[model samples]
Target: MTNDELQQLAAGLANCGKALLRMADVLMEKKEDAPAAAEQKEPEKKLTLEDVRRVAADKARQGHMEEVRQLIQKFGADKLSGVDAARYPAMMKELEAMGNDE
Candidate 1:
């Protein structure tokens, strides 16, 4: 190939590499910022029935099942799995309060 043709190809490749680098920087920036944005935008998630049971079992393991049972009774739940999803947060909060009391 002519010298001029080779130079033109090299220049094109350099520009492409620069573009790829810019794109990489943009992507890396998003990845870096995503966690902070998520930390800010993600509200505390509502707990599920499984979450309630896990916490209850944790309490049970800690010899606090009586307190957990009391909370279940207050919620009209026969067992941790019986508690409504909507009330899981309240149950977890009460459990946390119970934990703090100990």
Candidate 2:
């Protein structure tokens, strides 16, 4: 409403803008230096299902029979009634097909 009041308001706004610009400059500087300032890191190696299968097969072929048995016990078998009698051969066939595919 008054010239002095408007000038005071403008001065306040200018101070806020300067503060925001300084904060932005500091943030930009940190971002620019972040990668080099931190460790040059290696990308992590991810183990896939195929990697696991290959490792298990290798271990099995090397006579890690108990390891193979444990893996089969852990993740291979479907938990169902009469699974051993009902699905064992089919499972064997599926495994054989998988081996053939490989």
Candidate 3:
């Protein structure tokens, strides 16, 4: 190839190398951000019967037995065990709120 053609080919290769480097940098940034994004989107922990029972027991120990019974009745359950498992989250929120009321 002519000298001018060879120099132009080398320059083109350099440009291509720079472009690939920029793309690599961008990909690295995304790789670093992925974990944080996943952490933010993670689902909240699921509530369990024992979890609700623990909170209720705590409230009752704090002398809120009557309030606890009222909360259970509000959910259409005559007792804690009678309350549906699906209601555990709402029940936990109310139970936590009871502590905050103090």
Candidate 4:
């Protein structure tokens, strides 16, 4: 890539990183401010199966399964040990079914 093209790509990445950081900050603030948030949450009881399914589906729709799998592999199943990895069979099935759907 030309220097100008590389510079533009770098700038775009920086902007994206900044946006992600802003989102993280907002999440942190909410967690700190909401004392009852944890108690009121049902996911705490069993972890949100729907959220996991949605995340897998979203990643599949976005053609990012490889990235998602890589993240899981890197993080290890133990990292999310509370979650039942067996339940993800459906997510993977859905992801496979969505191959090239995008």
By TM-score, the best candidate is 3
lDDT of each: 0.84, 0.60, 0.93, 0.64
Per-residue lDDT of 40-92 in model 1, one digit per residue for the tens?
Answer: 86677777777778878888888888888888989987877777788888888
Q: Order of all candidates by lDDT, from best down to worst?
A: 3, 1, 4, 2
Using lDDT as the measure, the top candidate is 3
**Compared with the true structure, what per-residue lDDT tens digits does model 3 show for residues 25-74?**
99999999999987886686888888999999999999999999999999
Q: At residue 20, what lDDT does model 1 achieve?
A: 100
Deviation (Å) of 76 in candidate 1 = 1.1
lDDT of 4: 0.64
| Backbone collisions counted per model | 0, 0, 0, 0
The model with the greater TM-score, 2 or 3, is: 3
Evaluate residue 26 in candidate 4 and report its C-alpha lDDT on the 0 to 100 scale: 100
Alpha-carbon RMSD to native, per candidate = 4.3, 12.7, 5.9, 22.2
Cα deviation of 41, candidate 2, in Å: 3.1
The TM-scores of all predictions, comma-separated, are: 0.56, 0.41, 0.64, 0.35
- How much is 32 displaced in model 1, in angstroms? 17
Give candidate 1's error at residue 2 in angstroms. Answer: 32
Instruction: Evaluate candidate 4 by giving its C-alpha RMSD to the native, one decimal.
Output: 22.2
User: lDDT tens digits, residues 13-62, model 4?
Assistant: 99999999999999999989898775675643332557665766587568
What is candidate 1's local distance difference test score?
A: 0.84
For model 3, the superposed segments whose C-alpha errors exceed 4 Å read 1-28
Candidate 2 lDDT tens digits, 1-102: 999999999999999999999999999999999989677787745544454456556656866656456445644453322234434444344434443433
For model 2, the superposed segments whose C-alpha errors exceed 4 Å read 42-102
